[model samples]
Target: MFSICLIGVIPLGTIVYILFLFFDNPSYQTAIHIFARKKCEQRANKNAPYIASYLSCFLYEVIKKNDIVDIPVSDTSINYSGYAIRKNSVIYRFITPVADMPDVDEYNLQKILQNTVIGQLNHYGITGLSSVYQDTTTIVPSVYIDRILYSEEKHLVAVDVLYICTSKDLLYYQNAVRESNNKNKAERTVYDDEV
Candidate 1:
C-alpha cells in the first residue's frame, strides 16, 4: 500500500514541478538565478568585487546557454559599437566603456558585459538575436547604451548602459538607471508636446 501511494505521489510531484518551471512568475526566475549565482560565487570567492564580476559572467553564460542572443564578429570598416539581433527582426547596436580599451587584458570582461546585457534583455522579454557587435572605445567607465532598434521599425528606443560593479548590485543599478531615463524621456515628451 505504501509503495502504491509513493508511486502516485511521484507523478503528481513531477507534474507540479514542470508546471512551475513553465508557468511560474517570471520575476521569480530572475531572483532565483541571481540568488543562486550569488551564493555559489560567495562560497567560492570571498572577494566582493570578484564575486560580482563572476556573477556577471555567470549570468552572461546563462543567457548564451539559454540561446537569448548571438555574438557578432567585429568589422573594422564600421566605426561604432557591436551589433546584436532580437526577435529575428530587430537589430541592436551596442557599445561599452571597455570596448576600446587597450588596457583591458582581462578575457572575462566581454562575457560579463554579455551577461549584463542578457539580464536586461530578458527582463524586457526581448529574444531572437541575430548577432552581437561590440566596440570598446567609449569614454564611459561603465556605459553600454549606444543604440537599440527593431529591425522592422529602424528606430532607436533607448541610450543607456546597464552598469554592474558587483553581481549583487547589477539589478539595483539597472533598475535605477533605466527608470530614471524612462522618467526623463516621459518628461521630455510631455514638454515637447507642450511646445
Candidate 2:
C-alpha cells in the first residue's frame, strides 16, 4: 500500500519529515527533473511559480524509466501548467501515488487543464495532475451580490505550499482502495462506487 508520507509538499527543504500516515507537503523535484531532462529549462524558469503545476502532471517513477516528451502544444499557453507525457505505461512493483493515475478525475479544475486532462488520458495513457496555485478549487454556479464571481473570487492560492497536496488529495486513501477492488472498476463499477 502507498503511504501518505510520500505525499510531499515543495521539494525545497533540506530536512525531510515523513508523515507516514498522511502528509500535505508539496514537492515537484520529479517534475523539475523532467523539465531539465527535456531541456525545458527556459519555460520552467519563466514559469517558476507554476513549475509544480506545469510539470506536476507526471509521476516521478513513470518518467524516470520511460521516455517523456514535453508536448508544448498539448498545454494551454495561458494561466496554468502542463507537463510531459509518458511514452508507454510502465507499472512498478512499488506503490505509486493514487493521484498519478488517470482514473481519479477531478471535479472543479480549470477548463484549460480539463482539456489537457482528456489529452493526457487519451494520448499519454496516464493521468496524475494537480491544480497549480492559480487553478480554481470550486465552481460557483451563481453568487449573491455580496458574493463574487468565480473569476473574481479571492481563493487562497498557495505561494510556498511545498507542492505537498492539492484540494482533493486526501481522496487518495479512498481512491486507492477503490482501484484495488475494482480491477479497473473505478467509475465504471456502480453508478459510482462509494470509494
Candidate 1 residue-wise lDDT, 46-68, digit = tens: 44333234333433343344442
Model 1, CA-based lDDT: 0.39
Best by TM-score: 1
On a 0 to 100 scale, what is the lDDT of residue 183 in model 2? 51
Candidate 1 residue 48 C-alpha distance from true site, Å: 3.2
lDDT (Cα, 0-100) at 194 in candidate 1: 82
- Per-model TM-score, in order, reads 0.20, 0.18
lDDT of 2 at 82: 27
- In terms of lDDT, which candidate is strongest? 1
**Tens-digit per-residue lDDT, 99-183, candidate 2:** 1222212221222233443344345543333322222543211100110012113321111111213223223323433544475
Error of 2 at 108 (Å): 7.3
The Cα local distance difference test for each model comes to: 0.39, 0.29
